[model samples]
Target: MNIEANNTVNPEVKVGGQTLRWERQTIEKLLLANVREQRAARRWRMFKTLLWMALLAALVWALVAQPTLPKTPHSTGIGAGHTAMVSIKGVIADDGESSAEYILPALRSALEDSDSKALILLINSPGGSPVQAGLINDEIRRLRQKHDKPIYAVVEETCASAAYYIASAADQIYVDKASIVGSIGVLMDGFGFVDTLDKLGVERRLMTAGANKGFLDPFSPQTEEQRQFAQVMLDQIHQQFISVVKQGRGERLKETPEMFSGLFWTGEQSLQLGLADAYGSVDSVARDVVKAENLVDYSTEENIAERLAKRFGAAVGAGAVNALRSLPPLR
Candidate 1:
């Protein structure tokens, strides 16, 4: 009897004068597949790492980048005589765009430019922090005296309260006929939630080391003494604001009983009241008054990077607060 070979059990098979190892071929294919998989995984990991690094770099740049100044024709050496402009827009707070920190630097740069015949303060704001306004006001006067460059305030839509406080420092104030002007006053505003809490039967638990530590806490009740004290402080600040305006306006101010009563008026009425010098815009003032047709903006505006960084900071702070709130309270 002839015996046939079992192809299934055979590790190697001979065909066409060549020996082929079936098990070796299977093993090789598996190894290749594993290698390819590992390579693909490594590539993905590298891509993720690079993406993370790029994001980190961008965040770092945003945090460290300086604010960009407005590009003007006078960026290089002063070529021709021009009127320098610094915009005081939005709320005039310590952390706002029209803050003294930002405004003062722009003012100095504009005044220091030899080609600039005059500086114009383009103001449009409802008003904000008194302290910030006061600082800007003081610097404007000082810069004018030092540089011997006349500074004029050109009001647009509105210039009231703290906005007017800084504008008062200018040599002359020009306003549009329909512009809102004045509001020479001080105010401290807040809401009282004590009554609401009582109606809701919600108790407020507050602890403070000092008696006046929680003076203006909205959740708590305010004492008569505290109210009186706050009023006194506001009165003092109001007086200071009034004095500054008087000094800045000098003989031009036509003070009335309601002028400093936190009242606003039209720009036309402002001129009649001597709160403004004349009717003019930035262009008209630069062309006719300053005698320099060429205009150069020296405003120190917040750049994209600075704004991004600020927003990022706020987001991180809010996230942290939320995380803290979500945590379990300690015994």
Candidate 2:
């Protein structure tokens, strides 16, 4: 009587004839309990695995996705078999690829790397920011002196304006014969809306803390004094560009009258002008110079969505933390 019942009727479930029996209800209850226990255990294990997987994913992202300044490497670790190259592409702005943030780290890495036989800079830009270009040029010279490694600049399709300015600092600048180069001049461009504003019956009531503070404002008319002052500034910057080109190119620069007149030149013309060392590409540098034959670009890949998400999340989290912290001390 394993069955729990008040009735006299037998609870035995006999299958075949010979009174073979077991308490049916009790067995069914036990089986259901065991099934529930197994299901619950399986669910717990699955949950644990999911938790561990999530933790591992977070750890991997932290280690691989984040961009940090590379530490300088020892000479022996870099040169004999390895070569590190950096690509300078896009607009050379303060925050972009040609910017200090993007370039300085790579330059520092190359300078410190002992095993890197050659530090190659792949140039493909129309050029921007003379100051940024000059800074990068100074760094290239410093790095070259410190590391004593040859730095090569390879112009892909175009290396005009500030791009050429930066490339001139390289030990050898190579370009494709059809590549665009030159445009070594400073320029200032702005629009004047004073006449348009008068037509639109609007007034620009601008006040300046200093007499020349708003000298170049587009809303104001250009005065002779302002024009002269602006020329002085442009000349100062242009002189800097000229000085760098002279310093970097030495006797290599074959500047005709048009070379610094803000006009670009074809790759062959650049070579003729001594603006470039040779008319070849990265393959030439690698195969002919460093003898690496193969190249690897270790630049950190940027993910816009991930960066935005992280920034937004961090801002929100920081706000919450600050709000909590700012509240009067919790009793």
lDDT tens readout by residue for model 2, 1-331: 3423334466444344334334776789899999999999999999999996876577567657674545555654433666678889998898665687778887787657656777889999999999899888999998899878888899998898899889989988898889998898999998899999999999899998988788789998888998998899999998888888888889988768887788998988888899888876777788878888656564433445445556667989999999999999759
Q: What's the CA error at residue 32 for candidate 2, in Å?
A: 41
10 residues in a row with least lDDT, candidate 2: 12-21
Task: Flag regions of model 2 displaced more than 4 Å.
Answer: 1-64, 75-79, 298-306, 309-331
Per-residue lDDT for 84 in model 2? 70
Q: What is the lDDT of residue 134 in candidate 2?
A: 84
TM-score of each candidate?
A: 0.79, 0.72
Predicted structure with the largest lDDT when compared to the true one: 1
lDDT for position 254 in model 2: 76
Q: What is the Cα-based TM-score of model 1?
A: 0.79
- By summed lDDT, the worst window of 10 consecutive residues in model 1 runs over 67-76
Could you tally the backbone clashes for each prediction? 0, 5
